[model samples]
Target chain A: MSTEVEIKSFIVRNFAPDVPPDQLEPDLNLLDSGVVDSLGLLRLIAWVGERFDIAVEEADISPDNFRSVDAIAAFVADARRNSEVAR
Target chain B: MRWNDDQQALHDAITELGDLLSENRAERDAAAVFPRANWDRVRATGLLGLPFPDRWGGLDQDLLTTMYVLEGLGHSCRDSGLSFSVSTHMVSVGVPLLRFGSAALKERYLPKVCDGSAIGAHAITEPDNGSDIMGMRTTAVRDGDEYVLTGGKTFVSNAPVADLFVVYARTGKAGSPNAITAFLVERDTPGLSVGTPIGKMGLRTSPFSEVSLDGCRVPATNRIGGEGAGFLVLDHVMKWEILCSFIINVGEMQHRLERCVEYATTREQFGQPIGSYQSVSNRIVDMKIAVETSRKWLYDTADKLQRGENVTTDIAIAKLTASEGNVSSALAAVQIFGGYGYTTEYGIEQGLRDAVGGTIYSGTSDVQRQRIARMLGI
Candidate 1:
């Protein structure tokens, strides 16, 4: 699956289980829509780290990076790129 | 991780202060009084500034090293309340401000926090909202260059003697993740009043009270993080709080375990050492297990946090294990010591009392379990 697809699936399965994964918009503004609460955000970050094998630093934990599916996918890609470059 | 000579030296220095800090602990605990002199002594040692930058009068120690030193404090100091207050002062205000406060805020307040000249506390739990921080009714409205805060916080550790507080109040819609905001409110701020210290079951010498913020005006620059970032700020602080505070408990448990072992081996029953009996020895064995388990969870979680990984579940599990383990270990020590442990003179009863507060504060055991369940997608 693509990064966006997997992120959407995970978000839907964990946060908005009732909604079909495909129905969840990529730019839905999860924070403003209340799709994810405080605890939910932490869980999402943990899942992102484990699923993508990325270390989400404290500085990367801004609302911009986790506002929606597209942003999270972009963050995962960027973190992976950075990790590779550092290696 | 192996500690270098400098880290070892720092840890030893704090451990050496145990004698002075533990002096008159029983009397202080009995009176439920904060040990002002001991606090001053701790301030003098620069132990309070562990894990902070040296530019701000800290030792520039890492998280693991900080925990290591705190473990020493716990093992050597008999006054659990004073130790509790020490951890509270560090993680409550210093940890959050250092991480999230603006450069101006850091420059203005970090020095005081590091030097221990100004004690720190945080106001998060309200009478109506303990576990559910999102449901907090305290509100902060933006007014010109200041934010007007109106709310009340309860069970605020170090409140009675705290010079600074990281107060979380709602800045947006109720129950929204982005609703709450953190403010660096001073104790002397107008309309901010701290109630008299309330009595507690354990950690009695720590001193906690209710904090009321009635139309308190705080400069916008005093905000710790961006608007609506209170949850994130608190998340970071709670991670530090659980690790830093519970590592002390780990040290205390180790000490309790040693004392139990000495008693079991030395105290004779029916002309034989009590430790020779399986019943008595089994409890001591469990205490050992609890100490090691709590230590492992605390350090492992701290290591993970320092690596900047997401530790939402790991932290919750660590907190649950350490807090519950400390409680059980204390009870087991009391049991192993028998009547002597029950007596106030031995101070074993005080250990059990102090351990109970670990489960209640920093999120109750039930709350930790619930957090784990949520992380598990339940």
Candidate 2:
């Protein structure tokens, strides 16, 4: 599987292990859907940043980027790719 | 900046154990058992030995792991009494020995404590000196090869089943700042007697009793540290005890707040869920705010402790915040549960009773306020 899919699995397992990976879509609302909430979202972001060695900017952290597992995975991948370019 | 893989694994382990503990909470609370079976599981999981050296059959885990494990236990178990018992021994008794005990003492007792073959207690409170340590009247007179101890301690947790006690007694003139000394007293000593367990308003599952030392004789070898060192030992443990208790309160508040949210969203009133009403929803929101803020403070304090930073002021405020937040959250839970909250059948009232003890024990809410006031230079 792609790195995003792998990252998505990690985030979902940390908070909501019952959520199937196949059900994760890029546009889905994790909080509104009761998959994770504000505190859980921050925890997920921390997990992503640590696992992938990328720093997430506070300004860039919002529901738009973290509303779904797929979105979160993509965001993490983009951050990693961008940091690699900067280096 | 972020948790490592080992940290993540430990966190997951604690969360899983917490869920398991939560499942047995009701039965444990109802029966008020000593939780020997649960403790056995803890021993098998190596939690009983978490802080000791790995050479001595311990996990030797960091303080962070200890904090998380206890908090997870508090979150899921809902048995404040049992958690209180475990912590009193682990911090109040186990830590002092590990940190200050002579090599001989460590060799003799550390393994037993680590294996859960023995439980421990610390005696500091006296009939006249609940919060005032200097006012304690317990005395230990030095003899040729032994010290004869004569004093009484009340409200001691784990007294009924404790195999050892790290007891404090006056060894010098009354009111002397360095008059007090600490001793490691065994349970079956001639003059040492355990009183009938006191019936408490909350945390009843943990055995608490008055300890009477009438001419109790302890060998000089049993003494911990030197003359007048008891006060220092007491001071060191208080910060740890207060913080650990606050961690428990944070966990319980989280559980109760989550319960309120679930109940509010599902239970109906007037053809719709009661949560739609501002009255009910507002209380839930308040609970969330308290839980969230207290949790933040809890983590901040834990982090500060992990770094060995100066946190006297931070810890006092955190204790006060957590105690008050727990009381309010438990009360809110009762209201949300309605009549069910009042009865033991629901466990809400029990949580309130258990939470009330937090305000009184570990230096009462009044003491916490005074500390904060002093820190403010008022």
Candidate 3:
């Protein structure tokens, strides 16, 4: 699956337990809606770190980056591009 | 933090220093001194090495053993500031280094930390924000093999006297939780200046201050974990901080309970002792429950954390329970002591003062509740 699909699946799996992954909004404001919290935010970043093989910089742990599935996908793409550049 | 006989002996040995500390506590509290003598006495007992590995001159004890011994310190030592300082000195640098530092970093720094020769502290909270750490303004920019840091950190527990600091600075874009990074910055590093100690209402003996990084240049090799692992490093330290720091609060509550009981039974009022009155007696009963309840949540959550279960919620509850419980128990002690409690001569007032900080530090009770609320998916 694509990064966006996979991330949406994670959101559905962890937060929208009763809803299917495809049903979860790709542009949902996870932070404003209380779908994720500070601790949940940390856990989500950690998951991103592990799943994407991108080490999360503390500065990168912002609500904007992980605001929604599209944002997460964008973050992953940027992180991958940055890592590749470093390589 | 389980303890064997050896740990028990260590606990007893450290507890004896309580008499030494209690002697000049009021004087030190009045002066707001760091109690260097008490610090040396604690160092002599080898208590500083409790949680470190034998290879690094540590006792190689587990989390529970460390908590058990620290709780003993809280029970015996009347100076809450000293206990707070000791816990900070242990977890501030040792924890991050032991967990995230490279072998070279550990080899060079862990021994000094374990020996107490090099005091350790971590810098995270900013003047603009206390709990909203991700919003801190400190920045670290990469420049070849070094990162030039610029920002200020306030309310640092051991910053005034710390020989080294685990400084957290933003290396990535703002609003990104993982954008910050941890760096081990030496006290003597040029452009890094520690402000004079700032006074406080409680934990006064443990001085805090602001640390300024004005174009402070630290080698990139000084970075801890990966470039963005500061949050993980801090999260790990906070878990240990809540477990170890508030466990001491539990000890203080226990000691306060016993002292209140002794005073209640012996100090007669009217035709009988104050203990005879349900109003007075009920308060003591509640204090007992508070102490036990704090202990239960502490160890139970610790056990879960040790088993590798996600205690993000459990720890918040435990921290909230222990911290707020300490304040509740201390207030009761003061009320039970009546006039004596209000007087500094009896030191009962200090108990309340010390307990107040428990609720504020290590993440406020309100913040803990928020964490629990978040875990509840609300």
Candidate 4:
């Protein structure tokens, strides 16, 4: 599955179960819309870091990066690319 | 879990210091005075440096070791307010700086923090926002090399005497966690004002107050982590604060239980000792249960956190259990002590007062339940 699709699946399964896959839009504002509260966001970031094999530094934890599934996937891609460059 | 010889020695030393440091606590509590002498004692015992790196003038103790010593402090120290201040000073500014601060920031500030020469506090809860940390009205605007901070914070513990304040202010979109940012502001900075201590029902000796910043300018270098990482830093700090603070409460509850057990065995009513009465004995038994359960939840949660596991639900449960358990144990102690507990001279009443703040601070018992509910996807 695509990274974004996997992320969306994870969010739906863990955070927003009642919202159907199609209804939970890729660009939905998870934080502001209350789909992801503080604890939910922390869990999501941990999942993203582990799943993507990237270290989500405290500095990298921002709402803009985790605003939606697409944003999280983008962040993961960038982090993976950065780590690859470092390697 | 077994503590090493060094950890046991540290615990015993802190217990010894507690006897000397907490001697005048009742008088200080009566006067609502902040204990500078007690802070000095903490410094002398090297406990102020317990959880920091050894290179930074610390003993480089682990989380569990630090918790163990702090639990000893709670048990041996009669001054709960003083104990609260010590934990606040350690975890509030120190935890964030160690986690998110730049190297330069650490080099300059951490030594003083470790030595207890600098009293540290965090200003986050504002008049408008208590549990809703994201809704703070404080704003920080970047102006060249400095950030201009403007806002007021309330219920700031150690504010009246703190040397450094880790101030949280809005920097990005409202209601978003990333919208907030953390800034390390010095007490000597211009436009920063600390109001006199606000009288509280409990922890009066701790001396919480209002901190107002009117366009206070702080160096950009003073910001911990990035421009919008205040909530993340606070999230980390709160976990440590809750763990350390409630573990101290666990120690206090254990002490209370011990005292109650002693009183039950000695104090007589009717023909036999009060221990003969099921009502009083049952209450003491409940106190024991509360203390043991709180200790279990605390250590188990801390262990999970150390393993890089998600402890959101576990921490909430632990915090709730420890905090509410403290209050229950304190109340039970008072009843077991009978009239002596009610009197200020015996100082059993202070236990109830000190335990009350544990439920309110570090997010209220209600907020903790809300967190658990959220974790359960409710």
Best by DockQ: 1
| Candidate 1, TM-score of its B chain | 0.99
Model 4's chain A TM-score stands at 0.90
DockQ of 4: 0.40
For every model shown, what is its TM-score relative to the native structure?
0.96, 0.77, 0.87, 0.93
Ranking by DockQ: 1, 4, 3, 2
Which is superior by DockQ, 3 or 4? 4
Tell how far residue B1 is off in model 3, in angstroms: 9.7
Per-residue accuracy of model 4 over A1-87 as CA lDDT, tens digit each: 989889999899997889787778898888777787766777777677667766545224565788888888888888878878899
- Using DockQ as the yardstick, the better of models 1 and 2 is 1
DockQ of all candidate complexes? 0.55, 0.01, 0.13, 0.40
lDDT of 3 by residue, B1-378 (tens): 456798799889988878888897887888888988788888888889899998999999888888889999999999999899899989989988988889999999999999899888889989997888778899999999999999999999988889999999988766555567899999999989999999888888999999999999999888888776677678878989999999999989999999999999999989799999999999999999889988999998877766555567778889988888899898999999998899988888988998898888878889888877766756
lDDT of 1 by residue, B202-297 (tens): 899999999999999999999988898888888888999999999999989998988988888899989999999999888888888888888888
Poorest lDDT segment (10 consecutive residues) of candidate 1 chain B: B172-181
Task: Name every residue pair that clashes in candidate 4.
Answer: none
State which candidate, 2 or 4, has the greater DockQ: 4
Kindly list the per-residue Cα lDDT of model 1 for residues A23-68, writing each as its tens digit. 9989898987899987788788778888888765633346557878
